[model samples]
Target: MRVPMILALVTVLAGCADSHRWSPQQNGSARITTSDRIFITTPADGEYGDNVYSGSGRNTAKIIYNAASAKSHLVRIGGLAENYQDAINQAQGAEQDILIFPTILHWEDRATEWSMISDKVEIKVEVIQVQTGAVISSGIIKGSSGLATLGGDHPQDLLPQPIAEFVSSLF
Candidate 1:
């Protein structure tokens, strides 16, 4: 009887684990998306003289996602925009390079289990070089379909993929 009770407890715990998800470590080509011809900027590349908005003088980049897609997208963007700005501010102070204002939209891909498909307008971003007048970088943030199980419908952590990839590209 004790053995049966322990097995039942283990099963219950496993089920609970399935319901509460965690951010997955980025790995595999299918999970991570990268951009070519675009580069990440550093804080040393751009900076302002005590101006809160004054970022590195290099250039500026902005990200925009469709508001109509998922109800969660707005919340995701709000969180990511803050992170992006903070990254820009840090990059400016460190490298003095600023991404140009008015970003670019590469493409948006939706999350799916069997195959990765473009739907739901899940992720989109834009990047530009202000001085040079060039579209420096752009891409869609994406996550694995496996994330759909827990808090599925949409996973908030997947929102950071673009920022992470963009930073990686800069290096």
Candidate 2:
């Protein structure tokens, strides 16, 4: 009897553990040209359980890099840096065109079963001009991996889709 009740509660919570929805507000005047050289800044740390994932920032940057690299006009792609200023300094030193900053606003992972979990994440992206240090564009991207059965794929794998879509739309 107690086991059944516990199972029901787990199912309910699992169903409720949906991903975040982002309503991106864009700046109409912002423009990203095909000739721009791009640099992606590391994302901020995100909490998952008691430990914080510092790698989340770098991971998000990589996703953006991968998406942008496919474009022919993007001259060069910059790697992850410690923070926004660090990335800007590096981009400026390298004579890059634009610097991208990605921040993980919220990340949550809840265990649904012994082997399954639900993962949700929210990300904010900002584009800045490396030369003038002016913000060119800014938007929020959020998503989740709903009730994934853990084993074959990493839990946070699906989290990058929304970010990629948002970045792609900028160009």
Candidate 3:
């Protein structure tokens, strides 16, 4: 009985109950490597509601950079912008082999223990070739805090795993 209970717990926390989801709108065929010169642009802040906004574009960039680097994939971040066209222009103007662009759609942080609302994050990531400005891989990533928030959880705290998975998918 103890063994069964432990196994069930692991499945919930570490398996089926994964608090994040990635829906690829477009799957790009960009196999990357540490030798590949990759650049990233900060996504414009996603608008949630009136007077409410997402403030983790740079944070997301850092997360992606760190996660990808951990896998021996190097990435750069710069030319931050809130507009898609502007970001494209900046990336196209730069001298990199590829560009990773991200756009935040939804980001919410709530008191999970008190309000029973989970901290949620939704961002779309795209891989582009610098010269042609063609999208290689694109997907929407969504993450949320589960019943194990330890009271309150930050959206960024739940990003590493999903980001890691996304990065791995590139290779």
- TM-score to true structure, per model: 0.30, 0.71, 0.81
Winner on lDDT between 2 and 3 is 3
Model 2: CA > 4 A from native: 1-20, 25-28, 73-82, 113-117, 148-155
Q: Which lDDT tens digits does candidate 3 get at residues 98-139?
A: 778888788887777667677888988888777777778899
User: Which predicted model would earn the best lDDT?
Assistant: 3
Residue-level lDDT for 23 in candidate 1? 26
Please tell me which model should have the higher lDDT, number 1 or number 2: 2
TM-score of candidate 1 versus the correct structure, residues matched by position: 0.30
Ranking by lDDT: 3, 2, 1
Please state the error at residue 7 of candidate 2 in Å: 19
Regions more than 4 Å wrong, model 1: 1-97, 100-121
Clashing pairs in 3: 28-136, 28-137, 44-82
| Candidate 1 per-residue lDDT over residues 47-82, each given as its tens digit | 123422232112122221222122122111211123
The lDDT of model 3 is 0.76
Q: Compose the digit string of candidate 2's lDDT tens values, residues 1-171.
A: 999999999986775454655466655466678888887766666777786876766676777777777663564545556567777887898888888877777776555445345566777777888888878778776666556344333325655566666666777
RMSD of each: 15.5, 5.4, 3.7
Which structure is stronger by TM-score: 2 or 3? 3
In Å, residue 75's CA in model 3 sits off its true spot by 2.0
